[model samples]
Target chain A: MKCYYHPDREAVAVCSVCGKPLCAECAQEYKGKVYCKECLAKVKEEEEVAASKSNVSKGDASKSGASEGVVPKSAVSEHTETSSTESKAKKEVPYKGASTAKVVFTSIVVALVIIGLILLSTMGISGVLTPLSLVTSKSSSVESVTAIPYEGERSITVSLDANNCMLNVKELENAIDDKVVKENTEGAKLAVLTSVNTASRMSYKNGTLTVKATGLKKNAVVNLYLTIRIKEVSLESDVKNASFSISLPDIPISAKLSLTNGGISLSNCTVDRINGTIMNGSVTIKNSGVTGIYLKGMNSQISFSDNKFLGNVSLNLLNGTLDVKGNKHIASFYEKGVNSVINCDFSKTEPPMSATFKNITTEVTINVGKQPAVISAPYADVKADSYFTVNGSNYTTPNYSKQYSCLDISVLPAGETAIPLGSITLLGGD
Target chain B: MSDIDARYMLGSILLSLGIVYILSNVTANFSPFWGFIGIFLIFEGSYYTVKYVFRQHKDITNPLVTLFLGIAVLIFTFHIVIPTFTMLVAGFSIAVGAALLLSGFVFKISRKEVLSGLILIGFGFLIATPAVFNISEKFYRYLHIYGVGALLILLGLVLMIPRNKKSVKKDEGGKSDEVH
Candidate 1:
């Protein structure tokens, strides 16, 4: 084969399938017109109706562009006679191919969607989201918080009508290195401003830190942190206890937090594991993705809004209740107790999670799909009723172990009432 | 076959091979028969692609179709491959840690994402961490029904409910209202 670089003569080559003189510069390639210059242009003017056409029902849009200007009037010769029905059927093909092309694109998008779902489930969605730090102002005070930010020291500002500044932690450390990040500061120059009035007071140990400030004046600010590896850090404030405001950036880790007394708030926090207690305080968790989580409280009801969950989740109540609304679901739940009530609408959830409960003193009314998958408590008493509901498959655990179905029954002799949980066996599975 | 065509075919073949290989790796339960099936499909795809470009320089199979199938195959592989691959990555990360420990300042120059870098390191630990719990009371509340219903359903009703009881508005003042 001699090379003809942009020659005027139509470059021809042998077709691989049928040894025909195929014109390069106008050769048919891909699924389109890639032919000799002149013939390629001609092919463009008139697509081979016979070649691309297949048997599919199509309207008469074919005669528009190509056929009219395609074949030279003098060269109006038809070759390779096709069956009349075949030809008609063939005419439908190019259009079918066009439709098929669209379907192929759709299939691609769908495949991508399915793959994305798989990846999300397995790889664990990136804990990466905007920091949950938010500045909000009420009549006199505002609060903001973040969890698992950077490993080093971080600072945040809060609004309250108490002390000018409160120290959250005097010493903080990185879990990996156990490096001392923050330390004691006597009369440390704190930011001027805010509600409460108190001098900076702090004490630190291996993994615990204590900061105290009372009589907070308006416009004061306090900085908070895990303080240490956060072995067990508790933020509880009474009427006189100084309020702590936390702030940090998004950390790609999971955390289990417990709260009592004062309000605990956090934003943009993602967790893989958690079991928390809230009593006599409000817990506000936002933008957090959890695999398995539980929040239980009495007297002080806990509510979660704008939360995302991935796996098994449940809330039990002996006195107060729990409420949550957001974009996620429970794998399953099992509940039991009197006066304790379980209510959930499974239709709003993504996964098909359900619950089973032996409502002793519980009044359970949870919604799954359209029907209410609820079971009521036996006692139905106001005082001793316990109610529980969760999103997970039921499994019979060790007969002695307390099957989470009972909300208020803590004193029962251990027997064979264990519920086996087996649906989500994966690490992140509920 | 045109060099450009052959190169395109090669690229597609490589991509398809990657998908096939990944699929092979992740399957929890794999049979030699399925492996052969996957191999055959990939090889068949590659073979036709090469032959088309080399012999005829025209693709007989639709590229879009082939691309879709390849992606599906890759996803199938990802589901199977990642769990095992996680270990490999974990080991590699440990090695990197060792290297970093040894070559501290040397690696500091890649300060491009040092903040993110530290967070990621912690996150890796987080991924391996077991959950923690504290003494707790438990309550379950799905109280948004009233709010959601009020905002969504009742709001819709309110929006649809006209403020005007029976008064014809200025725009509604028609040409003729006289009854014969």
Candidate 2:
């Protein structure tokens, strides 16, 4: 028989209540019998009304019984006496199925919404990160690079002048040319200072090495490959629009590194005297130690960790970020910057350390170690979130002001230094 | 008003506004949902209006007219090939209309009352003519809104009233054929 709802489709079952032929999609089963959508809806409505009426009567009966201090059988009987002929007929033919059309339609809508969301997210991500691939492509090209093994320990002065190329320095028993790229762009030739591909030059003169590369076009890109190793070496570079990544072994060295429009990365080297400068790029110094260090930068970031400064460290930056962590010890740490942020964690410092950090229009945070010291920040708000002692009074929550600008705080009883012009936040106790 | 009346009134208003918003946002899309809500409002409104208004007075022309017109509008709006708005409205209008007509006969009403019911059925059939004859889209659209809106308002008014317990019991008694 054809379905009552869909005449084109065959009827899978007949609604027991309404006696209508129903297709599989429209058929609903309840109590072991098939029913159509309309019959199911009717049965549900009737059941709900009956149930609600019964509940109301039951509640009324209970309330009356409680007030009269006796059990009321009227409400109970009202529910039990619902054995009408019509209700009996409805109960007798209780086998029916629920409708599925609503379910199918809802599922289709939800699926479409999910698909649209996924497409939108993918398109948004690709649109934002489209041009980031040019900076990382072809950045490692080297030519005329030779390696000479070291015979004995000797002092070396390494000067690398890469005008538009990366400079890398490492420590080994031999010196090898760490040239990055050898590219030949159309209608542009490099002024090769040394006999090398692409006008890039490098020559060792009287224990002083100078490397230079020039001539660049707008659309022309060149990958500079510089992987050289010199033990006890001094590396210098005055580069414009070039980045550097230097990694050397633990050796005593004097180095002055300078760059104009690129970032610098230095790791795993111990220096006697090291000074560096950068413009418009970040500086990353990690896992290294120095006796006396002086560094300056403009529009760049400076991050360092896991090293010790035996003598003193002075760093100046303009519009930059300074992140330092895991220092062994420093005799004195001084920093000056403008429109920048200094985020430092000195929770692992040895005793008797003095630090001074000053900035303008900047936000600074210094997490101090377990040493007694005086913290002073005049023009900024200072709140002691942890327990500390100031002027012989111990406090867990203390406020500092002009009358009480100087604060002596420490987890341990040892006062040796002071810091000024930065918000100092102690680690943990909070 | 009682809390239950206030709740029901608020619910009706919110649901009506929600339905109208959904319809206005995308009239063509989600037609099934729209139709379902429209039929529900029609039936619920018709039932409450008829039950309460007729309970107070057995012979009231307003409720009878509303009942007849609501059913007729449902028949016209729905009546598709599937068990969509078409079947739902058809079954509801036919069942409710037949019940009222039979009740009228059982009560042995006046000639005017009988004629009123017959006229209601005739109007219902007439309303269905647009769909049957594939009339102008503009006429069909106008009929759809007026039909659904009228029923919804009538039902909303019904739900807004606080249901009296004794009145409900009288309705149940009337349904069991306790009175002619």
For candidate 1 chain A, the 10 contiguous residues with the lowest summed lDDT are A421-430
- lDDT score, residue B107, model 1? 25
Question: Highest lDDT among the candidates is held by which one?
Answer: 2
List-wise, what DockQ does each model earn? 0.03, 0.01
- Candidate 2's TM-score reads 0.31
Q: Name model 1 segments beyond 4 Å from true.
A: A1-168, A173-249, A252-260, A332-338, A356-363, A370-430, B1-180
Proportion of true contacts reproduced by candidate 2: 0.00
| Candidate 2, RMSD to the unseen true structure | 31.5
Winner by DockQ: 1
lDDT (0-100) at residue B180 of candidate 1? 22
Instruction: Give the alpha carbon lDDT tens digit for every residue of A141-219 in model 1.
Output: 1111123223454333433433112222212222212222223223233232221233544434433333333333543
The single-chain TM-score for chain B of candidate 1 is 0.24
